[model samples]
Target: MDMLLGVVVMLVKMAVVLGVALGLAAYMILLERKLLGRFQVRYGPNRVGYFGLLQPLADGLKMLLKEDIIPDGVDRRIFLVAPAVVAGTALAAFAVVPFGDGLTLFGHRVPQVVVDSNVGLLLVLALSSLAVYGLALGAWTSDNKYSLLGGIRGAAQMISYELALGLSLVPVVMHARSLSLSDIVAAQAGLPFALLEPVAFVIFIIGSLAETKRVPFDLPEAENELQAGFHTEYSGMRFALFFVGEYVNMVLLGAVTAIFFLGGWHGPFLPPIVWLALKVLAVPVFLIWTRASLPRLRYDQLMALGWKVLIPLALLNILVTGALLAAGV
Candidate 1:
């Protein structure tokens, strides 16, 4: 009976977390639209409902009701399953993200995270890297040349940037000396890694933007050449899943930046979660601002930047960090 009760409780908690995170991902799209509207001197999503608060819900409902179109001659099975894989992997990656130190619930002490693995940081990295597989499979299975091209570009881009991303973190791992995110946070209790590792932080930020496939690096979705890219043939809820997965990825990357560099849940005069949220949200806003301001890079330029510029910079950052740590300076 006790075991059954524990299982039920775990299931309930998992459901709530998944529900809330997915809902939040939906609204983040709406939030971006409304904010960008203000930036562009126009109102956004105001027509849907009450100051546009309900816009995401309406959009979600519309997608749900829309037809699930399977393009003729496509690999139907993978096409049907790819979006779920992407969205599910993205959400499942959040299980190790620590929301707070701990909380009191029904007089029981419980950790805010679903699973706090010893190698939580590595888990996050592995899951993110694996997401590219879903994209590759989806594009290939779609039987569209454009989608195939986008998928190839995306794979190459992610592969190139992920090296920089991983290298950029060597300093953090060196400083923290642990793969657990909690340990990383604890190491930064007084001083954030951003202060000590500014150059690597910048590299990481750039690499992260690439990893998330944001504008300026959104070569996969280059409309002129690839149409809608990997999901060009998808529509309605399936498309919505891909959309939500991308934004959720943004949130995840931002959270990682906060936790590893900016001092996760560390601040004055406010709760840890609040501080964490504020820091993490800043990354996505910066991304949106970049989208509104900067133009996308040419494919060759994108590849050149990753290979010629970011990779070397990230390696140098790692070396410098190693020197600093050795000098104990």
Candidate 2:
């Protein structure tokens, strides 16, 4: 009975998390467009609903209703499955993310996260790595040279930055002395890892932006050059899935950053869930600000920054952290 109850609870949590994630992803598009417009001195979508609040809904409806076009010579089966792979993997990464502390309701205790695995960090990294497969497969199967080039660039960029991303978190893991994200959050009750490992924090942020293919690290989807990049051949809802996956990834990365460095759900005065939400929201805003201000780097410059700069700095951070630990600091 206890096992059955646990299964039911898990299903409920999964439903809630997925619903909230997808909803937030849809609205985040609206938010990004509005913010970008404001940054560029213009008004964004304000037609459909009050201040264009229903713009995402209208956009989603349009995608659902549009004809899904499969380019001639494309591999149909792989093409059909690619967007699902991207969207699914992005959503799955949230399983181990703790949004708040445990809560009790009706005399039942429940964890705030979907899965509180001891190796949650490893699972996150693994899922993130798998996302590249979707991009590569989609681009290759499309049989378009532009798509192929974009996919190759994306795969190379992600692989290069992933080293820095993983290494950047080493200090956090070492400081927390646990791979479990919940324990890591708990460890920051007094002081967040950001204060102790600011270098890692910066590296992780840059790496995450690259991972999500945001501007300045968005060479893969350089619309001006590659003509929409890897997903150039995608249309209708299939295209929408890729777009949604990016926003979902942005939110997840923000949440991960918050959990790792900003003391997840640990702020005073406000509710824990509210604190977590604010922290998560702050990251995407910063990312949008960056997108508005920074020019996309040249491909060579991008690769150099990731490999020559971020990786070496992350390694140095790990070494320094280790030395400090060894010295009992």
Best-fitting candidate, scored by lDDT = 2
- List the candidate 1 regions with Cα displacement exceeding 4 Å: 1-9, 104-108
TM-scores for all candidates? Answer: 0.95, 0.98
lDDT of candidate model 2 versus the reference: 0.94
CA lDDT, every model vs. true structure: 0.87, 0.94
lDDT of 2 by residue, 266-323 (tens): 9899988999999999999998999999999999999999999999999999999999
- Give the top-scoring candidate (TM-score): 2
| Clash pairs (backbone) in predicted model 1 | none
Report the C-alpha displacement of residue 147, candidate 2, in angstroms: 0.5
Clashing pairs in 2: none
Residue 268 C-alpha lDDT in model 1: 93
Q: What's the true lDDT of residue 281 in model 2? A: 94
